[model samples]
Target: MVSGIPWLTVLWATPTVGAALVILLPAAQRVLAKWFALAVSLAVLAITAVLAVGFDPGGEQFQFVESHRWIPSFGTGYILGVDGIALAIVVLTAVLVPLLIIAGWNDADGQTGLRGRSVQTYLALTLAVEGMVIMSLVSLDILLFYVFFEAMLIPMYFLIGGFGGANRSKAAVKFLLYNLFGGLIMLAAVVGLYVVTAGSDAFDAGTFDFRAIVAAVASGEFVVNPAVMHLLFLGFMFAFAVKAPLWPFHRWLPDAAVEATPASAVLMMAVMDKVGTFGMLRYCLQLFPDSSLYFQPLVVTLAVIGIVYGAILAIGQTDVMRLIAYTSISHFGFIILGIFVMTSQGQSGSTLYMVNHGLSTAALFLIAGFLVSRRGTRLINAYGGVQKVAPVMAGTFLVAGLATLSLPGLAPFISEFLVLIGTFTRFPVLAVFASTALVLSAIYILWMYQRMMTGPVTDGNDRIRDLLPRELVVVAPLIALLLVLGVYPKPALDVINPAVDHTLTTIDQPDPVPRLAEGPTP
Candidate 1:
């Protein structure tokens, strides 16, 4: 089914082209601009679907790869490819963007105080973000990946600062500064890697091509001093940790999520933050295996702390948006824990969690947004017995919330269970500690649901309307995918396992040997 077509190029270019078209539209053609953006997103989704069908789940190497020398002098190139992991993420990005477009269509119509020009600007920026995110997923060149990675901030900054709530500017600035600081650190690491490569016998100059870098490392031609290597690892780790917003570094997330519009928050949480974990796997482990192994205990300990800390903080939140943000911090901890555990099941589970979290969190955020739009407030106390007025909306919110808590028979449950099982095989104590978050998760989600959707209808809740047709369209696919993946996750796991195995093979690491009880026979 594989075709010779430049699918990756088309996939990356479509949304950017759409953004240009929307921007070129006449000032008065706001509606046309929105529709055009939606059309472009849909097209990208279609292309992604085609990619999935043609993708070989058993393939051990990157597929649909396209490469060209962009900067021969520096050994940088324009490279794009996807393995099962990247393919899954690319599809997730495609699926969410169109739904986001639909969910935010009316909101973007300038009804919420954003004018026509502002609306157009919002849609264009959103499309641009979409394109960059996809580009990041498919890029096989570290330099190209970093370009897409850093470039994404511009449009997203505007998405928040220009189109977000009252303190949008301040939140946007904080988000920018935090990420920029991380990016600068990553830049230093990138330069250090290049220096190591150039000094090696593999080449006279360093190369930014991922394959070349991996080959050079594998041949033992590019060797970094152990001390320098550990520092480089920390440099990359700090950047991704901030981006993943792991615990102590996670301060920026709540503020940004609280201030950004719902759709923007979805993009940030669902797809963008994944880049951090994805980079940890793709770059950290692949390029610096010794450091990754050395740092495993520290990373695992932090992840466990994040799991408990995030869940406890989530239970204490009054702002619904901030609560969801905190929950993501907890969820990300699980993803990271699975990744660092290094078992095939754990790695695949982490990868699957990325997709499942994207779906589940999108539903939660968008459904919450629907409620906020109706009641004109983001406070949980402002809502009461909403089910009495809007049963469907209440039900959708419950389902999304349950998904977040990793309720059994839901998408998240499958991934979460695998992560625990995989981790328990090696680090049973850490697994047990991480499992306590399940109870805390239930308290946070159900408590929030009880406070917001149960009890008597509040004074203003009587006027609250049910989910409109457009709103349902936005959530229906997410819910359906969640259920489908929950029941039949084999398709995703099948695609993911090969890549996970390949990653472990590349790193030349095996699962930790389990300790067993001594027999009484002796």
Candidate 2:
């Protein structure tokens, strides 16, 4: 049921309005623009907290639901709602953007010859991206979700091309071309889906209403030829896979991550990437259960390949930024594997992993970005013994690194454990292969740490200063979350499990019953 408050519109529109206002601010008020943008992000965060508190996991599948006539000819509406799955990422997006704004405080200060006008543009673009992402998460109309899903690429493209390293333009174009190609394929699939609905006797007209179609699909009311369904599924999967970047399609990520500012990279990897994995759970499995089951083996194979492949490539990277980028690819592999495995634990753990990964990766990547900014380099071999001068920075880096490797007491460990166990119940050999990433992760992380932070203080490295107060503010909450969620993920899990269970029910996949080893009679 829709809430009385129209909270869904307010949740996304706040930042949209803020972005417009920030852009309208006079050029001289750049500092004011920055603070205003940050304020908007924080307000959005507060809104998410209210939604969380008001969200009753067991009450209804969608909360804060709202629908209105939009493009009546197309049978689409301005619809929005959130189940636990969507809410998890909405909250994740909200929590991360404020810190990202803080982390990127000086990233667009016209440092690389930005004519003093780039600051407001940078901040406004970030807010615009935030608003569009939230809209994509809550949207119940498929076309609306697709519009924002594709629209966000605009702000992000500017963020990548307008700021950061020399190769920024090249990376931005590559990122756009790859995703646009995928989106184009999905466009065909989306239209095909509408056409199928129009031809069906179940609807008054063709509609892009996601919930309506999901309901009809579930009741076996909306039927399409199996071959056509598979093609449609492939179209959607291709787009999401490119975004999720499962293996071979992931070449664009490393460049984009390296070229984009640290905060933007984090926003892309930690937040935007979650949406891809999210599409798989929400749309792929729900809308095309038979097709999903049929294609499970192929996807699981690619996921395992990506897991090991990303880790191996990361171990060989000489660039610190590139190394971290590769790690995200590996992490995304685990997320996809969990999703396709279809166990309740797998899906729940995947959801939690999305959130934990955002925190841990953000903490690590931002710290690394801080180091790179000071030294004016991203090469790993460029420095040694950083800990001698920047102990706090190195210490925080260590914790984030350990979390990345899924250290026993860190937040990622529990989620990783659940995913593996869940996958093992269904696909043991694939689980074993995927598990190899644990050792690979430890190697890359520890080796990088030893070279960059632990050895004797090299000549230039001794000049490296510690994290500033603002930087500490950025890292502290992420580290604290990693520790807190590591020790106790119940809060996150509680919100995620019901939603996961419902998805499993929708797909008709049951958790494998445990078969204990027989013991000798005592």
Candidate 3:
């Protein structure tokens, strides 16, 4: 049943209104714009909390739907709804938005060359991106989904191109070119899906409804030969892959993450990239189950390669932020690995990983940003004895870093364990290779930690202060989550499991693949 609360609309409006407020704030009230953005993000978080509580795990359908006829002649409607999978992603976005603003605190382009005049524009763009991401997460219709999916690229492109590091424009262009190419291919497929269903009328059917298409295809009412179906699936895969960016497709991620503002990097890696894995779970797996199953090995191979490749690269990085970026690539590998493994534990773990990874990555980037802000560089060798000079900062980094390595009590540990356990049942050899990444992760994380936080004080680092109250506020919740979820993940998992089960059911898969209790041997 559709939720009566108009929750999705509320979600969209909160950020939309916030963005408007940011734009309209008086020039002298630059501080007001930042507060307004934070307030809006907080409001969105409240709604997400409500969603988490109110969402019916057992409903077996999308909830909080808000549908309207946007274009009658085309059979298209402004349809929005959230199922289990989308719910998790939505909550992830809501959770990250506030943290993003916290990270963006007092951050204007002035240091990067932005005069105060541009602050409102930056905040507004951030809010706009939040709205688009929420829309994309809840959109139930194919065309609407595509619109929001592609729309997100805009605000983010500006955030990077305008406010990013020295190579900002180049990074933005690379991001756009890669995504546009994939999006165009997906667009053709979307059109093809429409044509495949139009049935000789040769006229536009005007409907791009996801359920309608799924039902029609499944019931054999709208037949596309298996070959054509596979082709269409590839289009969707290409778009999502470039976004999830498995292996060779990931060239944009490191550069983009490095060049973008720290907050932008967090949003892109923590929230946006998850959309790719998300699309695979919801649309790719649900809309084309056979293709997903058939292509599992090939996709898994890419994921495994990314896992090792990203970890290996991260180990070699001296740039702090770049190292973090590569870490994300490695983590995405784990997410996709569980997804294609096709076990309930794997799928659920992948979904949970998205949420936890977002929290951890956001924390790390924000803290790194603080360090760079104080020190004027992210180079690992720029300063030594940081822990001596800035114990609070080092402590925050330690917590966030431990979380990244999947320390026993943190959120990532559970999810990574789930993925490995789940995937081992389906793909043992690949699981073995993927498992080795954990060791590599330890090497890079600890080695970097030692290099940056354990040495004697240097003259360049003498002025470094520990985290201030505002910076601590930015990190506190993330630290709390690390302990909370690590100790008892049930609250999040309760909601996540049902949604995951729903997606699995939609794709017609059975729960939790069985295997020997023995874990993979490295």
Candidate 4:
């Protein structure tokens, strides 16, 4: 019903344009820029909220779609839409940016982060990343998606290199290099797709239309050599895996997360990295169902390894921020595992986990940043008995930590439960192994809290103040969201289940039915 509105364009363009407008603000108008940026983000959030309320989960698979001719001769058009999966994430992107701006209100002005700039640059970059992420999520044209997908790295690189810790430059370089290599591979895959379509009876000429390609793929009209398809699948998967930074490709993350300012790290971990996994769900599986099935085992194995490896290393981290970063690797492992398991519960749970991880991680990382800023250190040993001084911050930190470990009453718990349950139905053995992360996560989170928050005051940790009014503004909503979603995931699941059902229909993966034992003969 919202079809005529071009809402998707406005949703993304609001922030993209807002960033430019923000950049235009004079240096003397720093506070005005901050408020303006926040207002723009909130307006974007308002648009997403309207979309959510108007969205009919029972209706069209891709809602509020907008398509216009753009380079039509090249078989590419400007197109945008959202399935329940994409909408959920779009809303997530919208929700987090405003909070991040509030959390980062002082980052540019502080002694920390990059030197010599008004707050405008930091805020603008944040808005720019938000806009680009939304564009990537909503684009129905693969090449359009690819353009903004890579475009995101530019603003993000500046945020990290300019606004992070002492090693920001090195960390940002590593971050860019790893993702650039991944993008190069994905670009080849995108070109290969156009070539394959062009040569097929499926089209008059090469097309970059994602829906057209998906239709052809699902209908078996888009047949190609198994080897070629496999190569193409790997090409796309390689980029996503690296972006997801699964296991081996993950070396760039901890350093980047630790070096970047806390808010930027949250945006990177919480929002942007999701585009990778999102592509795996939308493109990899649906576009190459056969190849996805072919490589499912290997991918699942790697995901499981990432789960355990990340947890083990998280347990060993000496730096608090680095520990949080490692925990994300572990959480992302679960997300990837769920996606590859190819079960409705698994994919749905994985989708929900992305949102939950954003909320929980934002809370944890931002609160930690507040503490570090006060105490002037990121080392775990440098903090002790923080709870004795700043009880509110400590309490919120514990809640965020528990959510990270997927404790029973928090948001991540339900997602983790669904993912494991989904996996167990098909691959019980792998599920059993992956479950070990639960214990390891508990060890890392609780131990970290025990060491840093619970002991007697030391290392001048007593000087640590409680979360300020502004910090409270950032942490409160996240904690509430974790609680609300944890208890009533049914609302999200309602929107998500239909989409999951549709994806499974496209890829032809039905959930496995459990066999009941025969009743004893009477």
Clashes of each: 0, 0, 3, 0
lDDT of 1 by residue, 198-305 (tens): 787787788888887777676677777889889888988989899887878899999999898899999999988888888888888888888998999999889989
lDDT for position 192 in model 1: 85
TM-score per candidate: 0.97, 0.98, 0.94, 0.98
Off by over 4 Å in 1: 111-116, 513-516
| Tens-digit per-residue lDDT, 1-522, candidate 3 | 234668888888889888887888777777777888888999999988888787887885887777899877666789988877778878889888888887887656464354455788888988898998888888888888888889889888988998888898999999999988889999998888767767523334736888777665455566557888899899999999999878879999988999998998898998888888888888888778888888889999999999999999999999999999999999999999999888889988999899899988988888988999899998998868999989989988988999999999998999999999988887889999999999999999889889888889877898998998888887998899878988898877777788777667666778544645887899
Instruction: List pairs with backbone clashes in candidate 3.
Output: 74-206, 84-499, 109-114
**lDDT per residue, candidate 2, 246-340, as tens digits?**
98889899999999999999999998877789989999999899999999999999999999999999999999999999999999999999999
Best of the two (3, 4) by lDDT: 4
The TM-score ranking, best first, is: 4, 2, 1, 3
Model 1, C-alpha of 180: deviation from truth (Å): 0.7
Higher-TM-score candidate of 1 and 3: 1
Off by over 4 Å in 4: 1-3, 110-117, 518-520
For all candidates in order, the CA lDDT equals: 0.89, 0.92, 0.85, 0.93
TM-score of 4: 0.98
Query: Looking at model 1, which ten-residue stretch has the lowest summed lDDT?
Result: 107-116
Of the two candidates 3 and 4, the one with more favorable TM-score, higher being better, is: 4
Of models 2 and 4, which has the larger lDDT?
4
Candidate 2 has an lDDT of 0.92
